[model samples]
Target: MFHTILSQLVGTAIALFARVVTAVRGVWQGVEPVPRQRVYFANHTSNGDFVLIWTVLPPALRARTRPVAAADYWLTGKLKTFIGREVFNSVLIDRNPQTRREDPIVQMVTALDDGASLILFPEGTRNMTDQTLLPFKPGLYHLAQKRPDVEIVPTWIDNLTSVMPKGKIIPVPLLCSVTFGAPLEVIEGEDKAKFLARAEAALAALAQEVAR
Candidate 1:
């Protein structure tokens, strides 16, 4: 618990810096309290996605929202190691070494069982695409279905893809906007494929709102 709190404090400081930079360069708006238990889905464009989402979350919720990050990336180096273990309280999963992604599902499910909300990128890997409302991996849909009480929130992160994009580190520091659409409810008896498609569509609509 101490580690989690420390991370929240550190995360807040980092976000304050990022938000100021973002506001100066561009407009940063639309940040609000997320509905509890919501699973966030966004297009993966930059390393900045994790920090952006972490900073935007309200102080209280930031304590509980766990970002599902890649183990290979965040688990290795000393700095990555500290951020992952201390501040972010990330659910670092093996995205590359395993033959199957289901391995991460088990780990995430255990976290949810403990009542943690998640900041997840539905795209399993970052792809170079302007329009990236990718077909979400079934795991997100399955998790929602298993725990119907959870609020499945579809979020779109606008400008992060182009602002920092991929393969660049020194965040050009643009105003990255986060749009949270209404929670998606899993209809009773809905199949996996149908549920996943609807969730993707919801995120697309949220992105449209950002564009306006």
Candidate 2:
């Protein structure tokens, strides 16, 4: 409760900075809300991806959308720790677990049951690419399979990888556009591979939209 209040306060300040950066650079955001419980999946690129999307989301929806981040990377230091818990309200998952028994689905299922939306990067790890969107892992497909009613929305963030790669500290403000594609629903008896393919295809379609 205290964390949420603090987050709303800090998030507002961050959003203002993002607004100016996006506005001056002519960034256009196309945002739409899904009525049912949904999973927002996007291309992984940079550290800025979380803030960029969070800033553009509507105030009411912002609190509900939790970004699933890498535990090892984002959980370091006091400031990152605070923001991860408070500002982003992210689900810190162990992407590269030493044990073969590691699973994100268990935690994801719990969150969905609690009626909160999720933001996931299907690639599992950040892929710094421009021409091609990475092949998706089955994690997203599994999520959709378990929660078929969930509105699985595929999104593309143009130029984010280039705007700020892993090592770079400063982000070169570009006209980054958040392109949202139509939601991909899991049809009855849909195979996991096909569902995963559709998720990738959906992102590819949106990436092409941004290129146009």
The candidate maximizing TM-score is 2
lDDT of each: 0.74, 0.76
**RMSD for each model, in Å, please?**
3.3, 2.7
How does model 2 fare in lDDT? 0.76
- Model 2 clashing residue pairs (backbone): none
lDDT of 2 by residue, 104-201 (tens): 78888778888888888888877865547778988887888888888888777777666677798887666666666678855888898888887788
**Using alpha carbons, what is the TM-score of model 2?**
0.89
Cα lDDT of model 1 by residue, 1-212, tens digit: 88767766777777887787564222223334744676776677777776777777776887788899988889788888988878888988887644546578788888888888888888877757656565678778777867788777777666776666566766666777766667786599988889888888877777776777
TM-scores for the candidates? 0.86, 0.89
Q: lDDT: which candidate is best?
A: 2
lDDT of 1: 0.74
The lowest-lDDT stretch of 10 consecutive residues in candidate 1 is 23-32
Report how far residue 86 has shifted in candidate 1, in Å: 1.1
